[model samples]
Target: MQVNLPTNLLRSFVAIADTGSIVRATDKIFLTQSALSLQMKRLSEIVQVPLFRREQGTLVLTVSGERLLDLARRILELNDQAVESLDSVGLNGPVRIGIVQDFGDEILSGVLARFIQLNPGAELQIRVGHSREIRELFATHLIDIAVYHSVERDEFTVAPARMVWLGDPRLADRETLPLAFMTKPCLARDCAIAALEGAGRPYQLIVETSNISALRVAVEAGLALTCRSSAFTGHRLPAVELESLSLPTYFIAVMTLPSAHAAITGLAALITEAIENIVSPPFDLATDCPIKETEDA
Candidate 1:
């Protein structure tokens, strides 16, 4: 019995597998839950096996489903590559972009709008997450490009900037404070810890969260303090001073797979130029040096 599967159905299956829920997958693919469910059902019927089982209100992929997930991803990736080859001829394909949440709304929104206008044929699939998660997306070939805080990886290109500590005005006077931080492997978390350790300033870990919004909420509520790039703090939260922690310059980078398409390269160039223009006239390191004494003296 030969059964044919639709590309949209397979794509929905992959989304459901990746997200583990119809609602979440629908959000990812911009499909309704009912539509996604119908696709899943059609897919199961075609494959002659149950793809997912509901347990504890979550969808769990069965063994057959797990096997199909890998194949579906490869098939879809190949299809995308074919479309991208056609896109290179005329510049008309989706460019998956991953961005860190810290780049304030205004800058990100404006940049994206301009990018869209600049390349009308290109569609942008934007994902907002921490630098690490974004990196994973890039590594897994899920996203074509990423703009995120630089990780200590030899593979990525670095764009360095001055790091700053941001906190509520209420916590500005406190000496030994509780710190709010994201999960491990985050560049911001690493920089925050390194700054505290370098300064010999002891701090308590008040809240450890993976959510950027939640971290901001904790910091605003005086539950903890956080370290982020100054660019991120510009217009998002309340005005906060960077009086305590004197951290060295940090970096964020735009990364893409080495074998990515020419359109990806073009988009990366556009994003890099925009970010560099915004963060230019970087901190001057030459002024810190002492004046040399004259030879006659």
Candidate 2:
């Protein structure tokens, strides 16, 4: 008989690996601790090997579990894709959206995938650049909706976010820190500089480019330290803690014209939902989202 692992088991396994705690994974998988434990037990019986082991009072994946985790993600991804594709509607029309690069690429990818699956006929035109440029595009009616990072809570505040220093470990050893950042109008860069200057820390700009990828490369290569929203920082460019480097809180905002279409509103809601999911500590999806009116043309 061919061995078949249930989808729910894979989901529970992935949640456990991602969260590192069965208790935390319970909230994500919506399973009681005992129920999730049963699922894991069933998975191990199917695979005929222990999937996870305890280490320092935390759940750590066994070697077999590590290998299975990759397969599990791919399977779940395909499963989700097929379901969405089959359920997609034939809604059509253009929906132009502008977003800043930092959190835009990561968060919006999943959000856009869902939106596109639901509205298969909708033509999406995405413009990625500085938040100021994106705001200009929306102001000129060149885009239907705009999402960007900002320090101001003026009208477009979608949710509260924060800028944090991220760098390779070796960067900390240097007396004069090397910094990587984009051009002007970058909130992370501004916050990073403000904190460093306020502390009177010595630093030099080693990489200055408008490309986020370049900044990431510079940081990962230990060329310089870069700052990004806590939403965007990860194991690739882990957050670096410095006693003197206190940064400012950043905000995610959406801009829409006065007479925006229904699609724009729908997309805005989807984007807000996506942000809430990715942000740490979970922002209130309903209360934090305040739709601000754009200035008249």
Candidate 3:
């Protein structure tokens, strides 16, 4: 029997295995949930065995799946090495990219450094700001790529993150919710305010800044509860319980203009891979009991 497995399918499978959910896996795979699910089904059919199983309500690899995973990693490593050894992929060129403030941390720095190492000749310009700012840069054709959050899902969406309120749980008991968020023109701020208003919860904005570190500081100080995406969840700060204020999921989108050069493709792939590698899974409702900070937000 001659059955050839596609590298793309292998990559998606690896992503799912690493992230433990089709949804989180799609963040790096760049496939819609339905499409990713189809790929999983197809991959299972090719192997003629069940690949995944539920254990304690969480999806995990079966024994057969584990065996396949070991082989998949080697295959992917060899395939990627061969592709890179070609060295004439046109990955070197000037590329301008804008990303949201939340990603101004090690996530962006590490990826940018890696991209520069891979394509030493490539000139890079990075802009970090609110999603609206990044979108504007992309819209004006001032940037080749844009990373931002959006309510609408499109071909560019790489990840869908649940909105979470992170801070001292004690703050939630206040008569008026106190908020510390990014300044105006920010999606998190707007959503937090809207959710509060809709819930008829009176709130006061105590701290406003464009810096995520500042927000974390305020949250750490028990100043206020700040709204953030699940992408920022791997910290010690507790997720403030507030069923009255339900936040919406925001899609982390990436936009790259059409280009003949592989620079855009290479950079975009690195960005998604970096994000998937760094972002911890979204907060679990069961863990209202705050846990230790595993990583910097």
Candidate 4:
């Protein structure tokens, strides 16, 4: 007999994985903890493998669970997309949005295409810049909606960011650091400098530019190290998680203007969902990633 995966079970599993807790996941999926647990049990029974292992009171996905997460997300996304497309009333008026560059490519690929699909020929203006630049644009009303990473949750935060230092592993252990960052007024740059200086690590600002691509190129060439969220860096570069590189959790946020119209608000909601899907489950997705000293160690 061929076993089938149920959408309901996958949805609950994703909710638990994304939120890091079945208790919190309950609020998202509107199911009680017991019901969600039962669904997880059923899912594991079908898969015939244990799906979750708890860590520090938070649920971490097992290898089998991680394997299921990507497929589950795709399944639910297709299911939701099919449903939404059937009733998606295209919005009117141009919507201007600003997204920070770190998340630009990953986010825009899906969001822009989906928006266009839902609202064909809808006038959509988008700007990509550093987080600080995006915030400034939002403040000046240059953009109706903004998606950026920030240290503080002054706006609508969608997901937590796992900031890591990306560079050649050989260079990361040097005494004096070589740093290249997006010019002043950048969140990642600011955090990197602060963390290094706070740790009393000698450093040189080897290069400075307004382009994230330029900085990443510099980092990839092993010219200098820069701070970036783990969301985008894993495959291309070595991520260093040293004590000095250790930084606080940041958040990807969506901010909207108070004067925005309903269409802009609706677009903001769309952006919010997109961000959540990307990063809600991105954290701790890797094991060789940063881990703190065990209390018992």
Q: Give TM per candidate.
A: 0.65, 0.62, 0.62, 0.60
Which tens-of-lDDT digit does each residue in 1-297 have in candidate 4? 998888778877998999899998754455678989999998999999999999999899999999999999999878656544543456544567888888777767777778777777456667887787788888867678888887875548767777778888777678888888787677777777788878988888888988777876888888988887765553477577666457777878888988665556777888777765555235432341333545775
Residue 191, model 2: Cα distance from true site in angstroms? 1.9
Q: Please write out the lDDT profile of model 2 over residues 57-97, one tens digit for every residue.
A: 99999999999999999998786465445433443555678
User: What value of lDDT does candidate 1 attain over all alpha carbons?
Assistant: 0.72
Per-residue error for 73 in candidate 2, Å, reads 48
Candidate of highest TM-score: 1
Global Cα lDDT for candidate 4: 0.76
lDDT of 4 at 283: 42
Q: Tell me the whole-model lDDT of each prediction, alpha carbons only.
A: 0.72, 0.76, 0.77, 0.76
Could you give candidate 1's per-residue lDDT for residues 138-201 as a string of tens digits? Answer: 8877788888876442445445666666677666567776788878867777877876787777
lDDT of 3 by residue, 178-267 (tens): 889888888888888898889899989889887778887788888888998655544566567797798887777778877424666777
Better of 1 and 4 by TM-score: 1
Candidate 1, residue 239: Cα displacement in angstroms equals 8.6
- List ranges where model 2 is wrong by over 4 Å: 1-91, 283-297
